[model samples]
Target: MLQRASNANQYFTHWVTAAPESRELLALCLRKLRGLNKVRIIDASFVWTEPHSKRIKVRVTVQQEAFEGAIIQQSFEVEYVVASQQCPDCAKSYTANVWRASVQVRQKVPHKRTFLYLEQLMLKHSAHKETINIKEVKDGLDFFFAQRNHAEKFVDFLSSVTPVRVKKSQALISMDIHTSTKSYKFTYSCELVPICKDDLVCLPIKLAKQIGSIFPLALCHRIGTSINLLDPNTLQTADLPSNTYWRAPFASLANATELVEFVVLDIEPLGEQSGRFFLAEATVARASDMGVNDNTYFCRTHLGAVLHPGDSVMGYHLTGTNFNDPQFQELENSSTYSSRIPDVLLVKKFYARKKKPKRNWRLKRMAKDEGELLPKKADQDRMDADYEMFLRDVEEDVEMRNTLALYKAENKKEADAMSMTETDLDDDDEVPKISMDELLEDFEDLQVGE
Candidate 1:
């Protein structure tokens, strides 16, 4: 429904097709009323069609009573069509159309003078007969009247009308600005470790292969136990711990000593089968010997290690010992390592897949075994039983439905004659009619060239 204001206190209503409980229509009405700051609602009502119509009609009327004793009245009528389908067995139909109607009145008024009057009322209503200071009273009067355009006259009148008391105290006036563009910022961080043979960290070959499969972007850097002795002055390099051991076949690159920490840059999701993963940047920060026993070794902790400025490593890596048991088995098997590797690089990938879709195989097999199951007269019997129950429930009361139907039939007959007479009267007046095509042409001509 649409409406246009013809004057300050009048409007022309244009009825359009709409749902009774449409949020869009409600929002439009609210926006119109909000824009008219001085308008005060007096009363409102809605009219709606009952069930069983191709289209339900909604009518609403609202009156604004605050415009210089003027009334701004508006009416809207809208139609909505319902969709329905019939049941195959009983031939009974059900509709999906539903609507609700509600009307409310709202008013807006200026409250500056009312607030001042309320303050005065509070002072007058006080039970204690405390003496009010003349200077304080004068200050109060001045402050109250200073808000109005006729400040001098208002202040004089206030002073003559009442006495008041005032007290001085520091009061902070604060204002906060909330903007739509304000947003939240998030921080992300990650750590990277460069591979070293002396680190006493012998990851399972299967684990290495799984890591490679999952994080193809990761580059493994192999270093031997001899690399720790490169600086002979540091005797701390060769002292192996009692419980850890270093593995063999390490790389000879000294440049490997410089890279250490890795950081995550971004993450992206692959398809449902591949899963989501992260891309990261990493660089070496510190080189140190890990303590080793006879067969096992542990990498030493490097303090204050920092990745080089801009080298980004992309791959997934595991941190902390929390692999699932079955996953642990996968890590142990060399064949599995050759097949699919888990990523243990700084860049990580997490895969997600759709669950298996439900299949109606059981139902299909049952149907095939049973052949066709046709609806019997049992449905009619059930309907008869339902009708009997409905009658039993209403047998003792007056038939309101029947009474309404009779009344509507009589009223409809009268309405038909009245409508015919109204049509005759309209025919006598001979209103000028424009063809729809002509109206469309006129509307098109009115459009500005663009």
Candidate 2:
């Protein structure tokens, strides 16, 4: 069954350890019918008199056989015994190190935001469905697969979505006694790129000249297999591939910190009147500490059109080492560079945090009686009436038709199964018990009749 490529012909026996449905039983019995004089089964089905019972009565009828003769009719009954045990998937889940291959993903960033975002993408694309387990780690996520190909497939999916650097390694676990070929366990290490959106980077002079963007600085607009950089001054853009960024990684990361409220003293628009970029003279100080640095300082921003002379706006300051300095410079450039960096090279705009309406946050929860929590008696009565109406509708429950068939076969009387079931259900009467001996005698009688 495992080797078969098509599920249409697969058959599950009683050893399958789960309740086989009517379709599974029919498929099993059809295989049995094929062996009897090469019989072609016309119809095969199963029935369970007692719901939730493992015992199934399979009825089969054949319309054609290998031998030609007068029309022959036959009805046969087959019984299946199902036992309870752990399934293969459940066993793999319970066992440790059962996976053949695992993909380990990591990021150098401090936060788990990129990993969490990848998790959502994986779920949307169903990239990890074949994985035995998906675990979240402090740095990233781990995906374990029953087959090596499934792990590789998920890794490909991860690479398609994000910039991932991969390396593979294997460890010998055991050796074969006959061929002496060692069996090795495999693992793939996929590390996501460290930089992310809206980060400030101190660009290297060599890369700066190649990309033709803002010199010595750029802001990250997007992060993928390629990095998209935008010149904060000129609004120009440069997209560098992963290999290029790695080979010349002089872009020192500048973390985006908390918002700083800068009071506007003077504002002037740059270029055309319709342009978004603006030149502003503003003071630098924390929102909490409004005392120091009240004097105006030169600052450039794209949001100057919205600000008035007194309105307060927030911004993020870039902080990083100077890449052109002799201490960090690997390449020689004749042009002079600043030994000491600016106090704050640039301040990127952030959303002005709005103050929310005040309300009591810690209201005490109350305890109530169980009777109050339970459904009201009126609701219970309505539910009972609705159920009764549903029982009267035989079309809603096809199994109820079997009760009619049994009544007609035993009593030879025309009766409505829905009405009979409804009357019995409404009575709330206890079922009369029958002994094993009586059941055995009834079975014998049924056999004799057949």
Candidate 3:
């Protein structure tokens, strides 16, 4: 005889095997397919009937979601057979049944409506005017000009509304420091060029901090060499009081060169600990020549921050060597060293602290629970009994006997020396030797040692 299987058999089996609740099963399935663009699940039903003496037939129908906001239907059919057999060795009778079922699952194509709607929203609500020269724009929306390729359109829009024609400009700044003389200088110049004002406004204190932090490690080797050059004996012991306004000689090279003009944006005090330090943000008149070796080189140097009269600025001599290569290499090495020491120590300490909780918590809880479980008198008696048992066990062990023998031999040597010393002291007094039988009698009268 052939037996039919229901369409819900495997589906229900998998669902039940997965979790106790249907909602959990559904959540797990959804999590598995989260990255899929479009997905649809169908409720399927099957009907089975015995068509012949040895075969069973099944018909299946499934409902699935379709693209373009419609429902899709699919169907399939299958058959199975049954046979009787006996085990060859055991002589056990058995019935064998084979069954098959066909099912069709449909998937829908992803719809493009959401993306189209977003595009429409962007076009409608976006700033219509090309150039938005607000005092400040949101950081996320500030790159609209480059992102949309609307630079020309924005400039055209700006020219029509504002009387001051929008023009691009470049700035130049130079910094120099003398270690022997302990002096520093900074000069700023501004030149008009062809760039947007949004790029110019990007200069701020945060940017200055980002640049200044790199200065210390970037010129570490140079600074170390300069410190070594100083006569240690002549080095001042007392910390010098920083001046309010320390002046250094500054030369404006931009005035002599027609390439780029620089303007001093603003100079503000960053923060004062032992000495004063300032951050200067400037606009470059020309962007083309704004590299380390170019007129803009000084802006990136250590001398960018003004120094006090006694304070020394640590930096490479930009006049003689390739400043960019050594500066970058030194920064990379310092950054690598900085990352290793702190990060490894932090991870080790974190895991060590994490591991301690298991033993610590257990000990604390055990102490608290033990206080209620055992009376003080009972605990004390138990400890005393345990200690006595331990001593007896140790005394009976063969290894412990050997250890005691070794200790006795060492003690015997010290006792023999003392006996010899006593004998030497008694040399002045005549001492008579005793017979073996008499000594044995004296030893028998002594009590046994523990």
Candidate 4:
């Protein structure tokens, strides 16, 4: 309700977010009056808008002395009970296997870090507000919605953030014979690209030639709708976009945990401090150092300008594994997976010495996860003040105040036109065209129209 308007007797006014319209409220009053069937209604009026009353005014004509024709009028407020009934969509929200559309979101990579980060991102964006329910699966998450268009919107959001391939399918739920209408349940499968930050991948030999790289190795640097790869030897960058990656699919070589720490032994400028990379000579710290020194490796970093000889760095090194072990395969026949990649690939440099990560992983950690991240005191105050925090906009109940105002304006104009009395004289000219009194009369006319 609005603050008291000035001159309340002349222009009754109130500010309301929503209220029952004249029809629904008036119906309740009519029903009550009809309950007393003895009364015959001659005239009834309902007033409940601008120049509005605190209560909905309803006047019904009642005959005081029957058959004598003397009548009296009685006025009362319209009233109705506010009842709650489960809507069609709300009824289905609590049941299982009742989804009109579902989205299965999964990533090819084994790590769950990307999915974890995605959860926070969606929370901030309010993406799941329209979703019926969310389920956590082994590979990723599943989203359920009441409409297929809602699922499509979520899929588009995912595609914007990650390189994903989408497949859509629908199953027929039922076909109405009389109405000749059919209903279907849709399913959207979104496959996120397996590559993530710090994962090692083996470039195809053909792709290596195409990328102008002699070594068939690259380390995943960053992932943002596309995979960013960095060459440890040359510090060269390559992008794997959603459009072209399908043609030359790279094989997953290893993860970030497979990396070993290397002590920086020597440093050299690649080209310039402002260039792409810096070169360095480093010795890999073995599990147990042998009596004789070995395992000295040539490594590269993007932050070589800030690095010194003694600074330690963590990166992936291509050492012998069971898959490529000599004992597992006869080296003589170099048939299929013969040509192996080079020694090392750089991922990141440790700006802070103590918290140096042994492996590189995409996505940052959240401080707290829930509805809000603020402290309890401040969060509670915000929750109390927010009128629409937990409320969903009901399409039918949305107040079309703009349209209502326009209608009221037009209706008032028509009312004024009809209320207008004809000129008292024969013609408008006979009314004294431009006298001082005529001018004052014109101002009065404007005030009445207003």
Q: What TM-score does each of the candidates earn?
A: 0.15, 0.49, 0.13, 0.51
Between the candidate structures 3 and 4, which one is better when assessed by lDDT?
4
Q: How many backbone clashes are present in model 4?
A: 0
* Residue 449 displacement (Å), model 1: 72
RMSD in Å for candidate 2, one decimal? 28.8
**Candidate 1 lDDT by residue in tens digits, 1-450:** 233221111122332223344554444444444334554444333445563453435554556775678777877554444433222211211112211111111111111121223233333333111211111111111121111233323323333322211122222111112332321111111111222221223333442343232321123221122122211011112211111212222221212222233332222222212111112222322112122322211111111121123333222233333434343444445453434332233311111111221111100000011123332588435433433322221221122112111111121224322111111122212222222222112132254878
lDDT of 4 at 252: 63
Candidate 4: RMSD to truth: 27.7
Worst 10 residues of 3 by lDDT: 343-352
Q: Over the stretch 244-345, how does candidate 4's per-residue lDDT look in tens digits?
A: 776655446776546666566667756533244565444434423333577576645565654567655567655555444232243223354354444555
Candidate 1 least-lDDT 10 residues: 359-368
Per-model C-alpha RMSD: 39.8, 28.8, 36.5, 27.7
Q: Please list all clashing residue pairs in model 2, or write none if there are none.
A: none
Q: Positional deviation of 95 in candidate 4, in angstroms?
A: 5.3
| Cα-based lDDT at residue 103, candidate 1 | 10
Per-residue alpha-carbon lDDT of model 3 for 26-96, expressed as tens digits? 34333333323353434322234442354433443456677887887766544434333222211211112
- Identify the superior model by TM-score, candidate 1 or candidate 3: 1
TM-score of 2: 0.49
What are the lDDT figures for the candidates, one per model? 0.26, 0.51, 0.24, 0.52
lDDT of 3: 0.24
List where candidate 2 sits over 4 angstroms from the true fold: 1-97, 179-182, 248-251, 264-266, 271-289, 304-349, 352-450
